[model samples]
Structure formats: C-alpha cells, structure tokens
Target: MKSNKKFYMVREDMLPNSIVKTAMVKEMLAGGEADSINEAVDRLQMARSTYYKYKDGVFPFFNAENMNIINISLLLRNVSGVLSSVLNCIANLQGNVLTINQNLPLHGVAYVTLSMSMEDILVPVDDILDKLQDIDGVINVELIGKS
Candidate 1:
C-alpha cells in the first residue's frame, strides 16, 4: 500500500520533443518500417532518451481509443429543420457522423440511420439517447447498434 502512495504523471508541455518522438515511433511501427526501437529512434531522428521518456504512454492518432463504433436510428418529426436538430445533437455529443440515410417521410415521421464514431463523445450513450429522445421535433431515438 505504501508504494501506491506515490503517483507519477507527465506534464504535456514539459516533454515536447519526447511527445513528438513518441508519435513518430508509433507511426514507424504501424507502417512495418521499423522492427526495433533503436531503428525507429534513428529513422525518426529521435534520441533513445526521448523514446524512453514517453514510449509507454504515447500512441498515434490511428491507435485512438475507438473501443467500438455504433449505429443509431432516429425518428424525426417530418418537418423542415427537424433533421437538423438531430444532427445538432450528434455534434453536441462530439460524434463523427460516418453515414446517414433518410427515407421519405411517411405518416408524419421520417426514419434515419446513422453510423458514427463514439470514441470522443462527451456523454454516455444512455444520456445522449435520453436527451435526444427529449429533443423537440425528435419523435424517437434509438441506438441501432453499439452506438
């Protein structure tokens, strides 16, 4: 328990060079360009000391925490700007809309299907879904898949 008393943290600005090197190392590893850390450090013009400073904690953009991608379905009140409201909700959630499909409005309702990235969302799915369900002009909202 005593060992847990000490916590380690790295400030973002303190290791500027090392942070950049860490990204370079990860890119090299992904492209099958470097098999060894020494090679990666040399190829990216990074020092072994910099690599050691941030190696374990740094990762490239491609390795972001996209644990899962999910699909969503929204019921919009078939009216002008109604779809826009749904889109605004997605933006508020920081969701990246990959695809969207809207069918012809039938019975005053339009069904929509959206594929979005939830990796950087600002809120949990249930909360977003609930808020969407409560939005004006949004008749219904449901996550079709893991979204």
Candidate 2:
C-alpha cells in the first residue's frame, strides 16, 4: 500500500520564489496541465524569496511529494464519449492524467493507455479500476505499470 503521510523535501538552493513557483506549477500540472515547477522556475528564473512570499497566497492545495505515478491500460467499447467519461472519472477520483494514448477502434474495441498519479486519493486503486470497468462503455481495466 502507498503511504498517505505528508512530508516535505527542500534542497539547499531551493528559495522562496522557487518554492512558490514550484508549488503553483505542481498544483496546475496535477490538474492535467503542463510544465511542472522545475520547468516554470527554470523558465522564469525567479528567486526563492519571491516564491516563499506568495506561497501561502497562491494555492492551499499542496499535499505531499507526488512523483510516483502509475500507468494503466484499458479495453473499451468503440463508442462515442467513452474516453471523455473515463477522463472525467479520473478527475472525480482525484487522479491526475499525465499521458494518454488511444488506439484506433476496429471491431468495436479500443485500447487505451493512461499514465496518472493521485496525491490524495484514499480509495484503493483496485476499487478505482473496478469502478472504471463498471462504466457503461468500458470493457476492461488494468494497471500496466507503476513507479
């Protein structure tokens, strides 16, 4: 089982500006946005103090270190809007979709691969998959990779 405990890790060079930007980018990225804190900070070249000054002001949603992501695969019926429902389900479950790939449906079957991570999902992942499979158009769900 994955730990739900919260912990903070800061490097010697991590300043307040760096921290704030890092936190913001992290939050946005977790919501299916692009570019992590490292990318934004590296792009803006902001100091650590600036980040720290507005850290509490920006977002209060920061939970814990969330780099460990899981990759999943699924088989679904070749029908309209099924993928959207799956994406919505992931969001409702508090899981962030990092990457997605879907193969062309032939003979009414589609293969989907998703990479995601959940910073605060308390529900067991097995239950999550079962719920996804229970979707009207979903045929099967599987966890293919995790790290």
Best by lDDT: 1
Score candidate 2 by lDDT.
0.75
Q: Model 2 compared with the native: what TM-score?
A: 0.56
Kindly list the per-residue Cα lDDT of model 2 for residues 81-133, writing each as its tens digit. Answer: 99999999989998889899999998999999998886557688888898899
Structural similarity to truth (TM-score) of each candidate: 0.54, 0.56
Best by TM-score: 2
The predictions' CA RMSDs to the true structure, in order, are: 7.4, 9.7
The 10-residue segment of model 2 with minimum total lDDT is 57-66
TM-score, structure 1 vs. true: 0.54
Clashing pairs in 1: 70-147
